[model samples]
Target: MTETPQEQTAADGSVAMQAGRDVIVTNTTGLTLMEARQVAIDVFNANFIRLADEAASIASARADALREKFFDRLSRENPEGLQQAKDPGFQHAFYTAQKEQARTGDADLGDMLVDLLVDRTKHSERDIRQIVLDESLNTAPKLTNGQTAALSLIFLLRYTRNNSLLSHNALGEYFDKYVKPLASKLATSTASFQHLEFTGCGAVGAFQFLPEQSLENNYRGLFLKGFDPQEINDRDISIGLDRRVFMPCLNDAAKLQVSALNEESLESHLASLSIPGEDVTKIKGLFNATKMNHEEIRAKCVELRPYMETVFDAWSSSNMKNFTLTSVGIAIGHANIKRIIGEEFADLSIWIN
Candidate 1:
């Protein structure tokens, strides 16, 4: 559900694009540059908070449901074991099952499960609400009031819907219309970016991109510009962020495959598509970088070809379709992380800014 660089526009007359279901137009045309930038930041913050809250709420509900189902199953299946301490086998089996179930949940789920195990019925929406509220409060130091409000709006837009946010077009459009303005400001603000290093952002776009980092405890600040990624002890090195992108040639190839009437025909059609060597190389490098096995990547390419082709067809017919990443005026952050790991134990939170 991630939006490729081709699927976004700046909305500041810097770029005017309609990506899928969302339309991003230039909104900074009339206002002073400063006003335009502030407006963009406000919109971004609003969208961010909204998305964050939605993610928290969805995560909370899912975690609670899982906890209830698991404990209920455990209670029913191991009714007699709780009263006795002698059945180590039953205890081990129960715990093993619990562990497996817990694997399906993420960080928020883990927190919810601990609360549920402590007191099942006592856990409620209020508990999750409080956690989310606390998270917001903690993040407040990193954002302006306007930015916070913008984030809250974005969260509500996604959360109220019952369906999954699978449509990249819709998410992209929302960003273009509402979030792009703010993104411009944030991107331009050295201070905001620096502060955001510690204050993780809410999820946005189809990929649910969050500013959270893996190196939570190792955060310091940005190193010297253009520092090498190989020295882990160097104070200047930073952990790289993971930004997923869907390739253009692969996308085109996918389209060709889908329109074919049969698997054989699809393969034939795909074979005929003239994908560029650079794009193919980029795609291969992307797959390798993500640690995807060659066979799996090939299979994925085949499976995804059809939908991607449809996307391309739609894009070709309108302004929305004519977009490319370079045209979007947004710089996608890409870093070679293995090289980074060799160089630094430092957190990459600074890069989020």
Candidate 2:
């Protein structure tokens, strides 16, 4: 590998301000700065990012609560209360219910506004407050705010309560198939509360912004690692850092991104998906099926069960299932089909070892 150029520290590398407040970077570490003031800027930025992440998490929790509250009460699944559901006054009642729910949260959500509001001064609270308290009672199809906003959230729960996206039957099927099984798992899970893979923690794509943003994240890291903040920042010039160290790191960052690295199987959120309950039901029914009476077939079934179950487990992530096929998807899918349709159809065992 070609060596990084900026990592070549000078013979007597020292970073100090001789004249004024201008910052400079020195040394070979290629990671941090060498000035007190610059270090302070990083400190400030890191703290800001932390606070921002917390606020984002809280806002996400509130939106989830709102979705649940609306669907639970007004969902027009199959009901004896069709008269009120069909009544023209239902729109008013729905909005009124939402307003009431906003003011008073249920047992699951604790107190919606009170529980979610991290700090009064945070800008997120203002947005949430507007969402909760702003009275847009009119249920017309057009814009109710009397402005032609570019891209604003338009929630039409009143219109969809009967049969659209939130159709009672579709939700019920989804609940039974995808959600109900995960309810217990989620309740006990401490893994950053994944609401369909978008965690309350951090998620970002390819972002291009001012170097200040980069400094925000890195400055905090330096402080946390017990580096001498002043010494580090004093020698670290943004220009040298950007050209010599930072730019190079950016080019190689993607390779080091994920928690682990392996070539065992390529995985994608897309590819074909296995039937959810088929493997489980097969395992459950295997106890009674006369189809397994043949000892040879029975042994093969037993051997294939784990792979089938793995397919089931891997495919269970709703956030992952998509339209594309990956190497990982193919392996699991072939196994799943073998288990489901019998080995006569899926002659894939030869490819496994």
lDDT of 2 at 128: 34
Q: Which 10 consecutive positions of candidate 1 have the poorest summed lDDT?
A: 215-224
Query: What TM value does model 1 have?
Result: 0.20
Model 1 C-alpha lDDT per residue in residues 21-108, reported as the tens digit of each score: 3222333234333332233233222222233666656643543454455344335544332222112222222232234223344433
- Alpha-carbon TM-score of each model against the true structure: 0.20, 0.15
Please give the CA lDDT of all the candidate structures. Answer: 0.29, 0.25
| Strongest candidate by lDDT | 1
Candidate 2 runs further than 4 Å off: 1-105, 111-113, 119-121, 124-353
Q: Alpha carbon lDDT of residue 135, candidate 2?
A: 21
TM-score of 2: 0.15
Per-residue lDDT for 118 in model 1?
22
